[model samples]
Target: MSLFAGMAMDEESVKAGKLQIANYKLGENVHLFGGAFYLCYQKGLINWLTDWNPDVLIMEANPRYIATPSAVKWMHARGRKVIGWGLGAPPSNSPHFLQKWGKRQRGVFLSQFDALISYSQRGADEYAALGFPREKIFVAHNSVAPAPTFQVSRPKFHEKPSIIFVGRLQARKRVNWLIRACAEMGSKPRLVIVGDGPEREKLELLANEIYPATEFVGAKHGAELTPYFAEADLFVLPGTGGLAVQEAMAHGLPVIVAKGDGTQDDLVRAGNGWQIPPEDYGALVQVTREALSDASRVGRMGEESLRIVTEEINIEKMVASFVRALNSLRY
Candidate 1:
């Protein structure tokens, strides 16, 4: 069969290192609910069952989605390969089910599908730790966008200090610590938070109360992020795993990324940015202070951010990995 190669499998993409584009789609959604699908399981199952016309059905990774035995069986009956993407490894709930399955049973269960895609080696490791063999589990990261071509050359940086945080204000994100860190500094640096979330009001209140210098610009996307990345002296994320790190780096902003964010475990390097020990709020504060102090280091590291993404983490590599994994599927 002819492949979907234009936008999906563009030749330019191959040059960028995209291994594969999904030729067939399936009964799954990834974004909503962190890997959840619509309700009405019985009706949804029937809808997916009758409409089964693809080779690969990527099941949503949440417990509700994978636990559907009938859903698994229906796709199998249709002569299709079922794969799971959008799965986070170490903390994934899949092993809870697979652990009870025996050695042969475990192999059979994991080996059945076309392939599983995860965001990082750590994520892939999460599955491997679960007894899911490496052959079956694939590390396919989210796409990394290209650096924008500004009409004007990016202006040189000033010695003025800045600290930026990008991500939701969710619990695990640990944004409050950042507000406090800003408070700790006698000559507090400008603490700018870019994303919006449930903690907005409270965090804003805390920032206002503790460190009035904090700037919560609410949520931002697209070109909106550029100014923040450009203006920032140092980028800081107290929480784990952020697309912003990639975005910030693309714009020549160096990062102070939190460790164990699953995705950051792959890219945090002394060459580019500092990996603040995860949950080490005091360390996060101290590191942010130090990062901003070295103006020259920040400039060099910012360039490194761009270099790292260009050389190692571009989107082409991601798409190609997907293609390679899918093509290798035993189906």
Candidate 2:
């Protein structure tokens, strides 16, 4: 059976609900409808599920509120199997305690489903680490619509060859490391940030005082970020995994990401982008300087980055893998 489960997917940045709904429609072989705590404001989802009575209760990511056993109970009570779908990252390689906890929480929430969906091989391993049997795991990559063919022109900006960083401005994101790296850049490459967070005010001051070339463009979302992506010679994130790293790569911008499990680890490879070990400020600074000094190398890296996404990673692959996993469940 087929189903469409919704959740708080309208939030800015990354929203899983919209992605899930699209996947459900694409995989129309089974019944589809809202399930568990759908983000849709209309109440009585329980009644809605009870009424439609599909073969499965489908969802993306880790379930919230009615996670695992409770959600499993809810669906089973209605004579339907609960099929959890979405990416799950392993915590084995992470140094962050919070990341480990969050991973564990997702594992607990996902374990109750008849089967779990994973966007990448790394995500599938997270489930295995949680003691989930191979039969209970589904592995799939997310997918996206094909982008228009661009001649890959710069966004009509000056050729400053700036080092750009995007994503939320938070300590966990480790944006400060980029700022510190800029200070160490003896040639003084322009360091530009295209996001905002609680660390904004402090980061702004820190940039102005310590690294004069550093600039923060407040918060740019959706289309506003394209120009930066188009103009940047290299993108760096001193933090963990984020879909943005893939977004950067999609835009033909190579990323210098912190080494660890996340979306970045999947994108940054040997010759495409740099993945320095976590908290390696000196190495971060050195890599930034080296990449900035060679304009040709930087451009080639950007092209390679885009190639990585188009060739190996796309939202469509991710979504398809997830749907296949959901459909393979015995329950």
Candidate 3:
């Protein structure tokens, strides 16, 4: 498929093998209103659209993208189909009036699309709740590149199990909470923190003060990062983001992730791992202890983790969902 992006490939994303590089790039991405709104423009967009003339156009679901509305109008004029792809609608549980207004605006924007493809079932459900036709909404569970092989055997529980957290050290990640939770444990696991970010220094200081043995391995990707997942008995993401959880499962480690983006609902299930209440310290510690408490059970759970990634969700399934959504539409 021909793809376009607003940014060039970065060393980190390329090395991590996460993002698929675009065939062409648009103008520099502009963020307005303190980065809440995103807009990208390209003088060549119309030229590309005319030359390619795709039967279907799948655009970002975010209403804030300044070019999307015009693009949608362009496609509709040609009687071509358009699909809205995104994480989900605005937070359904948010009590803020602004969020409610945002959700309404999203609904109005998304109503223009011929079909919707969400990253998770939770997202699909949200779209339906927003009055999008349920039949038109498809779920493509978010994924990472699967491991070359699922050879990492289930880890045996030890006096101190190895717990790995892979992702940027950002405030929203809540790595500090992970440290505090481990510190309170009677038998703390060996915490290996992979990745570096703005919060790395503050996190390192917090780790030293409480969980002194926590390892900060800077950032490793591709082959360098695999060993960390292979060696760890468990993977924990205390804050938002679930991409690393998919990688951990592919390597046969049961995960413990806080309720983050709605994707967690699909990734962390009863069979594969635990999804603790977000920002709940007591829940994190309790779940970690229980997961590590049984060596054999952990192994079985790891196997389940592998099964989920292989049989249920991956890049292959994600692509298939896109194809299915396109096939279901009349173009």
What lDDT tens digits, residue by residue, belong to model 1 across residues 1-331? 1121112122111222334653332233222232233332323444644554556666544344434456567678877776666545344244665545533453455555556788788777766766676787777666557534443234445545777888767666788988898788765677888987677888988877888888888888788787777778777778765677777777777888788737776666787788877868889877877776777787888877777777667687687777877787654
* Location of the lowest summed lDDT over 10 successive residues in candidate 3: 8-17
TM-score of each: 0.75, 0.72, 0.87
Distance (Å) between predicted and true CA of 71, model 3? 0.7
Q: For residues 170-260, could you state the per-residue lDDT of candidate 3 as single tens digits?
A: 8878899988888877777899999988889999888888889999999887678888887789899998865778888888888898886
Candidate 2 per-residue C-alpha lDDT over 56-98 given as tens digits, one digit per residue, 9 for 90 to 100: 7766544433333544587888667776666664444456896
CA lDDT, every prediction? 0.66, 0.67, 0.81
Window of ten residues with lowest summed lDDT in model 2: 22-31
Which number leads on lDDT? 3
Model 1, poorest ten-residue lDDT window?
A: 2-11
Best by TM-score: 3
- Candidate 2's clash total is 19
Report residue 316 deviation for candidate 3 (angstroms): 0.7
Better by lDDT, candidate 3 or 1: 3
User: Model 3 misses residue 154 by how many Å?
Assistant: 2.7
Predict model 3's lDDT versus the native. Answer: 0.81
Q: List runs of model 2 lying over 4 Å from the truth.
A: 1-54, 59-66, 86-111, 129-136, 142-148, 154-159
